[model samples]
Target chain A: MFSEWELKRYKRQMMLFGDDGQERLKKAHIFIAGAGGLGSPISIYLAVAGVGTITIVDMDVVDQTNLNRQILHFDRDVGKKKTASAEEKLQALNPDITVNAIDVKIDESNAVKLVGKADGIVDAMDNYPTRYLLNDVAIAKEIPLFHGGIRGFYGQATTIIPGITPCLKCIFPKAPPKEVFPVVGVTPGIIGTIQANEVIKYLTGCGELLTNRLFIWDGMQAHAEELCVERNPACEACRGITTKTPARTKK
Target chain B: MTVKIRFFARFRELLGTDIVTEVVPGTMFTSLITTTARKNPAGYAAIFDEKGAFHEFVILMKNGKRIELTDAAKTPVVDGDEIAVFPPVAGG
Candidate 1:
């Protein structure tokens, strides 16, 4: 059920994943949790890729200092709500897809409600408390959590399928002490793209997901590697969950 | 015996990676890292607390398996082992 314009808009990418795959993208809804550095690229890419609906939430106003890596905002957007700028840019990028940008801080009280019914949750957040909140919601909702983090020249990403892979709590167990972490735009650009790639693959049912492995990127060394990750049998957040059918296999 | 220690992210920045070092046969995981990380005071501080215990957030793995922070003190490193220590990169 694609319009003539929709078909033409998605022509090049459709070559890779025929009409059936295009339909999946057209029917999916992805929830991205930030509108800052990682969220900028993640939402833009997903929007253009024809994901039918994108729900991006952020509470901060764009500051002059954000222009370096938060590409969704511009000098003109300084002092504008990040959600407002994100919605405008994402909608402009793909008029065919729906973009719902919400202005609110994501906390345990609202995380689940905010994510309501989305096919997947993209962790574009900058801190661990909210990331852990999103992780709990992902486990509770039994959806996939596409996790990405960046600091300076280092970044890491992993795809967590609720019952099938190690949950975030299982992997880190403890949160790192908070600090004003240093970063460069390319760091989030790389990690965010990896996360967006994971989302596209998850939606369209192509390629092996980043399941059971942590992809670590060291931009300083121009190297990328993955370490095997396993589910902790005693993980407090997802311990009771059991693998039934792999999410990818469910596709 | 010989073992390879790989430090990642900030740890890697402070202490280089893929460090091949010699250790006594009975060396424990904690001591091996303590000795290697000692080469750089900042690196040691980043991974350990004032009391020299591993920071709770530091993840340690041997041959692709996770080693709990508490168990690292008693876990022995055998010949040809590959150890990885890193902090979760926390940013967007």
Candidate 2:
């Protein structure tokens, strides 16, 4: 049941997916794990795409350094909490969709609760520990995890469908050493948009998901390729855990 | 025999990629990467530790199948093999 305004708002995209697909977007809820570089574009795109609800969690204040890539925040938002900045911008972007910007650290203690009732989880996080936590939750809930990471001119993204695909732990058994990594704004811009694209594709059932494959983007070389990845039967994070896909059409 | 080695991410920046070189029929996987990586000292250092062994975190694949770091030395490279070596990037 779309309002006249809602139908008008999604006219262009609705052409691709039709009214039923648009209805799915209007009924879906997505949880984004960061409000920084990657999160900025992901949430912004999803909001405008009319994902019915978006829960974005971040605990840091917008730093001046973040403005280069964290597009959700502006120079004036430097000292403000990222959640506050993100909420204001997202709500303004699509008043039709609901946005819940939470200010909290997504730790093991609260990761599950923070992500409650979402259709999918987007890993816009900068670090692997939290990404792993989100992976665990995705496996537990049988939700898809849209994973992306960026550094300098390199980024990698993969969609994990819990029991059906290789979990993040299966792909990268170890996390790289942390650094004050160098990055240009376009790096996350490229990667985050791919993640958002994956989300839209997943929700609309329009195309093949990035499952069982790692999409590697090398902006320096302008090369995009995918490497075949498989589930590790002995994966520490999801070994022996079988999951049933959530009934996406149950509504 | 000839084999092609592909390095990715930081390793690619240091060693360059899609390296095709001739090797003896019985060359092992570890030696093939070592010989190709040794052309540049920094590249060698990035792929291997001070002990001349692959870094623990480096991922190695042979013809798209994962080759364990411990087994690299025992794994022999076949003719026309494609080996991929990469280091995962850990930033946002």
Candidate 3:
């Protein structure tokens, strides 16, 4: 049910995915956990790609210091809420899709509700506690979680397909000590793009996702590599949880 | 036994990775990494605590499998094993 405008808006990309793929993107709803740094590129790309609904949550107002890496906000948006800024820009980018920008801080209590019935959750958060929360919700819902994080010139991304791939806790059991992490825009630009690319691929059922591997990008040396990762049998987060479909026995 | 050690993110920046080093056949995972990481004091400090144990957040993997910190001391490295050590970046 694409509008005449949508077919035209997504003309070039539709060539890559065909009309069916375009329809998948038009029907998918994605929940992004932040509107800063990584969230900026992730949401922008998803919005333009015509993901039917986007729910982005952020509690911080744009500050001058954020202009460096948080591309969603500009100098003019310095004093405005990040949600307001994000909503305005995303809607302007694609008038066809719906954008819901929530201004509440994501904690254990409201995280599940805020996420609602989205097809997938994108972790653009800056802290592990909240990321853990999102991970729980993703596992509970059996939805994929596209995870990305950046620091200085380095970034990492992994796609967690709930029951199929290793959960975030299985990969990194402990959170690195929190700090005012150093970052440059391109770091998130690279990682966030990878995340958005993951979302598009997931929604369209395209190429193999980044399952069972951790994609590491080191901008300093301009190198990218993936370390093969396995699920821990005793993983506290996903232990004993198998995919819904039972394996068929060989004849 | 020859083993390859790969460090990621800040640890990689400080230590430089893909280190192929020969260790005694019975070398434990912790000691092997400790010996290599010691080449750079800051890198060693980043991965180890004051008591020389792996920092709580440092993740260790051997042949694509997780090696819990509690078991790192007991886990032994075999020939041709690829070990990865990294700290997860907590930024957006």
What shift in Å separates residue A61 of candidate 2 from its native position after superposition?
1.3
Which model is ahead, 1 or 3, in terms of lDDT? 1
Q: TM-scores of the first chain across all predictions?
A: 0.98, 0.97, 0.97
Tens digits of per-residue lDDT for model 3 on A50-142? 999999999999999899999999999999999999999999999999999999999988988999989999999999989888999998988
Looking at candidate 1 chain B, the ten consecutive residues that score lowest on lDDT are B83-92
Q: What is the TM-score of chain B in candidate 3?
A: 0.98
The sequence of per-residue lDDT tens digits that candidate 2 reaches over residues B56-81 is 77888898888888999999999999
Backbone collision count in every prediction?
Answer: 0, 0, 0
* Location of the lowest summed lDDT over 10 successive residues in candidate 3 chain A: A242-251
Error of 1 at A178 (Å): 0.6
Q: Give the least accurate 10-residue stretch of model 2 chain A, judged by summed lDDT.
A: A242-251
Per-residue lDDT tens digits for candidate 1, residues A24-61, read 99999999999999999999899999999999999999
Q: Considering every candidate listed, which one attains the maximal TM-score?
A: 1
Return the candidate ranking by lDDT, descending. 1, 3, 2
What value does the lDDT take at residue B15 in candidate 2? Answer: 90
Interface alpha-carbon RMSD, every candidate? 0.5, 1.1, 0.9
Off by over 4 Å in 2: A244-251
